[model samples]
Target: MGIADLLSDVWGTFSHPAPDAEAPPTGGSSTSSPAAESGAEKEENKKDAKSDDGGEQGHRPSEGGDEEEEEEEETVDPKDTLEDECKESKECQPAKHHYDECVDRVTGQIDNDGKASEDCIEEFFHLAHCATQCAAPKLFAQLK
Candidate 1:
């Protein structure tokens, strides 16, 4: 897949709520408003309030669970993973070399000029894209 698609997938995975999660209400009247007056209505309101409060408390633990899962999922540093793949794959060598050269050149330019020019920034992105393309297969494999 293209880098855009891969990035979109990653973002989607992080941004989308869990399948079982109940989305919070977007717009609603306050539950505390003076609406329930009858005895049965007051009892039902109490039950609803208890359930809502319980649901919120229950949801906190699941958030902690998700954090643990995320930690497990991101055990490897992506840059190190890509470098390892680049080292193993001969096809990726040229792109890796170009990327390194670009980085070195940009570094030298920044050191000499005290800032990055537009062209240098553009070249950096180009080299980055090349490196990403070279590492795509192995990176995707690692992600899976």
Candidate 2:
């Protein structure tokens, strides 16, 4: 399965509590008869049942939380993060300059047209590849 699917499954499992484990019972009479004990247990079970139902209902997000999270992940630009990293390194100045210029040019083009052209996309990728090549040798080697 994809990362999105895996994350959704994990989120669902964590958000809901286990069915079998219920909260411990509160104060009860110490000298209760067998019938009274059973009845009391049933009453407690009923109260617990309502609470458990409410918990499950309350935990569910009104919006599609999983989908929103996946969308956020998709929208994140790796190049932005890499550019920031490059800015922090003196050795990566040349790469950082190229990356910043590429981003600026591509962003302006997309902003004007409302969508990226194939040529713009190709050029952005090529500039990004060059920036990667120009990055600090130790850091770039670790990325491989």
Candidate 3:
């Protein structure tokens, strides 16, 4: 059969389901379609979401409320992070000693090899010490 005939037959059969089927019977006094109520609910949800976002940003807090204090607490200055890095690097005196030991170890390995040139050995130890004691994981990541 042609597509038109197939569609018409389906349309005729679909006018009503058996009375005991899952769906509520189609004929009713209600003015609204089920699809229309879903659309209206979507619009209401969008309005509620927009209102919440506006409350977060636009409405000015009156006289030191919880929101304003929370906002102030959340902010962090860039200098604070820089100061933290500086304090950590400066206060850790043991790392300098650790780096010196690393240099000595690498230099010893270089000297143990009979054919390695002294100048190349010095350069390798310098780099190896920096990579090890200063930033082992960072150096390993770069190698990978």
lDDT of each: 0.66, 0.62, 0.54
Between 1 and 2, whose lDDT is larger? 1
What are the per-residue Cα lDDT tens digits for candidate 1 across 1-144? 999999999999899888998978796755566672567656676766677864542212434455554444546678666856655567656655666677787778889999765344555465566556767777778779
Score every model by TM-score.
0.32, 0.27, 0.19
What's the true lDDT of residue 44 in model 3? 61
Candidate 2 per-residue lDDT, tens place, 1-144, comes to 999999999998999988977889998855345555566566665666677964642233437456565434466555566655655567555655666677787778889998765344555565556556545464655568
Q: Which regions in candidate 1 have their CA more than 4 angstroms from the true location? A: 1-88, 116-144
> Compared with the true structure, what per-residue lDDT tens digits does model 3 show for residues 17-136?
767668657876543445545665666656666778645432333476655444346767544444335334644344445555656766787779743342344444544454344454
Give Cα distance to truth, residue 144, candidate 2, Å. 20
Give the best candidate by TM-score. 1
Q: Once all C-alphas are superposed, what RMSD does model 2 give against the true structure?
A: 19.0
Worst 10 residues of 2 by lDDT: 53-62
Q: Which regions of candidate 2 deviate over 4 angstroms?
A: 1-87, 118-144
Error of 2 at 12 (Å): 40
- Residue ranges of candidate 3 with Cα displaced over 4 Å: 1-90, 114-144
| Least accurate 10 contiguous residues by lDDT in model 3 | 114-123
